[model samples]
Target chain A: MTDETIRDVLTRRGLSRRAFLQVCASVTAALALSPAEAADMTKRLETAERPTVIYLSYQECTGCLESLTRSFSPGIASLIFNDISLAYNDTLQAAAGQAAETAKDTAMKNAWGKYVLVVDGSVPLAQNGAYCAVAGRSAVSDLKRAAGGAAAVVAVGTCAAFGGLPYAAPNPTGAVPVSEIVRDRPVINISGCPPIAEVITGVILYYTTFGVPALDHLHRPMNFYGNTIHDRCYRRPFYDRGMFAKTFDDEGARQGWCLFELGCKGPITHNACPTTKWNGGTSYPIESGHPCLGCSEPGFWDKGGFYKALSTPTGHWSRTGVVSGAVAAGVAAGLSTAAVARARQGRAQKKAASADSEPKNPTS
Target chain B: MPLSRGVIPIRPVTAGAPAGGALADAILAEIASALHEYLDTRQNHVIDLTGMPLSREDRQRIDAYLGQGEVSMDIHALVHSHIEETAYAGVWRVRHYDMGGGVHSERIEIIDVPEIVRASSADMAHSARRIEALRAEEGA
Candidate 1:
């Protein structure tokens, strides 16, 4: 692909060519595409028209927005605003009051069924959606309005995708996800407390490029959320060996043993954190000595404590009438020793036996 | 004595902080300590441990200890039976006993280990080494 087109776009947006190429490379790596595919992607990106995006905020903290902003290395916010035309975002819009509301209306009217709608945070439905209101309109009302003519709805963060903290226990606001309110269009759930920056950008890129990437049953992008963090965790070897961290700063933790015992949700949580990581793919929570909270999975908030170990059966040795704890330990020790002795004796015996079994030489 | 099975060597702790000295010296010391521990705690009363390498002797001893009645050495079989009995539903109980006269039973449940850790130990070790290298680079 000619760098001129990309460079032109970057120059117009006041972003460096290096930044634009970096975004392409990041997208390629995020999608797990080959180098050739990445080059092709760069070409496509250069030629493709920037998709229209409308971001909606509902009943929750702006943490998701903050996290999205924190996406380092060609930063997702920069890509979205500069590469793609972000039509309406209540949080970041320059206009305010009636003007701000008019901008959203104008964009929706203009784009009409050709825009991608991104919803962050959950919509409160309790009390006829009275819990959260914006500009004399309920959050639900606004969401329904925005989602009516959208090509696709992307539910960003756990709040928008799966209720998040707003939907947690005693959910006074009666908050619900975007999918619950808007049922007409296809909904892509990028679930996470505050999803990985690359994952968020990757989803957007996939949609922009191929038009709606493959999704799991949970409506998550299969590419980024298909595998469990435990599967790719660095401490996995310790798990296999039955070595575990009993406490946060104990010997096992210092040794980088599996955090299964200390309530790591990695075993059950599925995400690209271990591979895609955070801080520009620098390191994930697990590598930073924190257990996975399984933010990407649905109903994670309702699930038991974040620190609880995934329930694993103690194995057959603990069951049946074979041996008790002390007895088993003793037997294991004995059997191991016996097996070793037998192996050596067998080797020596084989040598002697072979010598005896050899046919006599004609000369002898 | 019957044929001896070669010992499955215990890997030295590789991820911990330096064991009170130079990295190389600490690693060597850790390996030696692991070997010593393997030798001391591995002996089992029931096994005939003659005519085997020291490592093999240690392994056999440990295996014998595990196979004994006290610890319910057949944990895998027990877990299987429990699953079969429970029809893979509800809580399954496994009994445990302390060195004292006290005894207790605990329920265990099924968990999904990420596919990443499902690889062979050798593969996991290699991945761990790579992770360590990455950490070292970052530290540097």
Candidate 2:
């Protein structure tokens, strides 16, 4: 079947055992697995057959492909791409026209019930699915056909996952996500304008290693898309201190203050951008002096002016006010508990002394 | 009494943050929380440090911050390791060695009791049976 294990591939490439283990550890950590699971993951990846992945593109800008290919440090291409058998990708595959379709079909037929169907971009279904086509066939038709025999369907970007930019208002083509088309199969969404390169590879590696990872309410991997960007942002301390950058060129901006006032959607956006960063732990949008556009979240394009702060009631308290109120309440509770404990200690000591001083009874 | 060994230079443990100390601090804070979890509910946590891109100097800096505790144990199993409890109780540092005696993997493990020190139940049972058999043979 020409299936090669990860260890065999690594050894053929002259990669050290340590390097292989490191990749295993990285993927394990990305999946939020315990350290013990890393060793198990390494063993699994060592002997496990590489799964066949059929990547289908619809109405995307190819930014996700760029992110996956152009990512710098940790070298995701070498780490992840070398391990998987990418059966079909229009952008990457050498085959053209009928040959490409034949290749995809051949792979699909060979890996039936085991292959992974990864869809990028949105599928248009406005006029009998006429907006996009592959091999003169509608995108919806192709997606349904591809997803039918696949083991799992992975929505690669915001486009395929949530109908992305094309699915925005005034829908002319009536773009719909892959999930809408593939109703029977489980769709794992890795959503982002152009999702983090490592994250994309991480999710793929996780599925290839573990059966199906634990996902969030949004059908995104919990480990990567679990926490809000604001919760993990380094500038969160500045936000809590109520120190915000009023303008892009303001003094606060120079001092690396919070971007909440400048319309940062970090509080509402869930992503690993703050921690994972982009370009191999270099920096993310907030660190590069830009307010988060909340790209990863659904309907981000319609989330009222990127420069406008989130609207709130006039009397609504700020985050600082809530923090201060909680602090005060905690201090009052602490003092009351301390006072009660001290009183109890005093009474116990008094009783002990009183008993000690009492006359002793003689025993025969 | 004459000094038997040469004077060993003691490096001063500085209180101020060093370069890349913030990253280490973040990791330490995570380990601290894991320690709290262990103490509160007796849940064990194993934090793999092998995946992180930590330089030798960065590791030394983190080690300096962790300091040392009274208890340290060296284990020589299929893979050799040096396990130590950090200054903070229930927080541990476990370093596994490769065949070449170099560190293969390092982890920050949090548990109520270190796993390496605990004997396996199966081994304990086997030893109990062996001792009883020996006593029976000796008629004692």
Q: Which ten residues in a row have the lowest lDDT in candidate 2 chain B?
A: B10-19
CA RMSD per model (angstroms): 25.0, 17.7
Q: What is the lDDT of residue A125 in candidate 1?
A: 90
lDDT for position A163 in model 1: 83
> What ranges in model 2 sit over 4 Å off?
A1-3, A14-16, A74-76, A312-364, B1-63, B66-140
Model 2 clashing residue pairs (backbone): none
Instruction: Give the Å shift of residue A107 in candidate 2.
Output: 1.4
Per-residue alpha-carbon lDDT of model 1 for A19-110, expressed as tens digits?
45445544665666533445656776766656677888987688777777765644434555444657788888779999998898988887
A188 Cα displacement, candidate 2 (Å): 0.2
Model 2, span A1-364: residue lDDT tens: 2466665666566544544555564466555555655656767787676767888999999999888877663343445663456777889878899998998889888878777788999999888989999889999999888998788888988998888899887668999888778878678999999998778777776667665555655677766776667766767767767888999987778777888778877776668887667765567899899999878877677655788775422233322342233223323443332344335434544553465353221100
